[model samples]
Target: MQYTGASIRKTAAHFNIPSFKAVSQWERIYYEQGKDALFKEQRGRTSKMGTKRPKKPKTNIETNEDLLAQVQRLRMENEYLKKLNALIQKRERSEKSTK
Candidate 1:
């Protein structure tokens, strides 16, 4: 499409594509890296050096112990928060009663 000297918007409208910017991007990629670039997966953020950053694992499922430790930590946090809330409510009630 770009080789014929047509504008990005004209080409996009002719092909019924939603965005002219997307057509311009495709043209840029095609010119820089050939047709293969159009089919390649382009997920994730690129690093400062222009390479794809390594993706981190979604979950740390290396061992049962790790999962158990996370659950225990979360339980402790929940208990602490509940105790703090109870103390705040008690103080508020005492203050209201005195007033």
Candidate 2:
């Protein structure tokens, strides 16, 4: 890998590489082995702790109290809708009778 050409040209000459320049380039990358001599750059695969499990967030009793109040508000809204529906039904019945 460091000074790959001189040995590769000799090996290629023995096996009969077509051109001296081609053997020189091949030896520069890989002297004896054809494909394995190329150095692959792999500097991006290290773990950076950015994807690790995070600490649990803090939860107070006030947050629970806020959720309970929201539930109570929804329940009151459901009751109001039921009363409004009954009033509409009664009005429709009275109008039908008058007609």
- Measured by lDDT, the strongest candidate is 1
Supply candidate 1's per-residue lDDT for 2.
43
- List model 1 lDDT by residue over 1-99, tens digit each: 646888889999999999999898888898899999899988778755867789897784568888899899999999999999999999999999999
**Could you give me the TM-score of model 2 versus the true structure?**
0.44
- Which RMSD values do the candidates have, in order? 15.4, 8.6
Per-model lDDT = 0.90, 0.73
lDDT value for model 1: 0.90
lDDT of 2 at 81: 100
**Model 2 agreement with the true structure over 1-99: per-residue lDDT tens digits:** 245545655766777876777667665556465576655543566776677688787665468788999999999999999999999999999999999
Q: Give the poorly placed runs of model 1, Cα more than 4 Å off.
A: 47-99
Instruction: Give TM-scores for every candidate, taking all chains together and pairing residue i with residue i.
Output: 0.41, 0.44
Q: How many residue pairs clash in model 2?
A: 0
Clashing pairs in 2: none
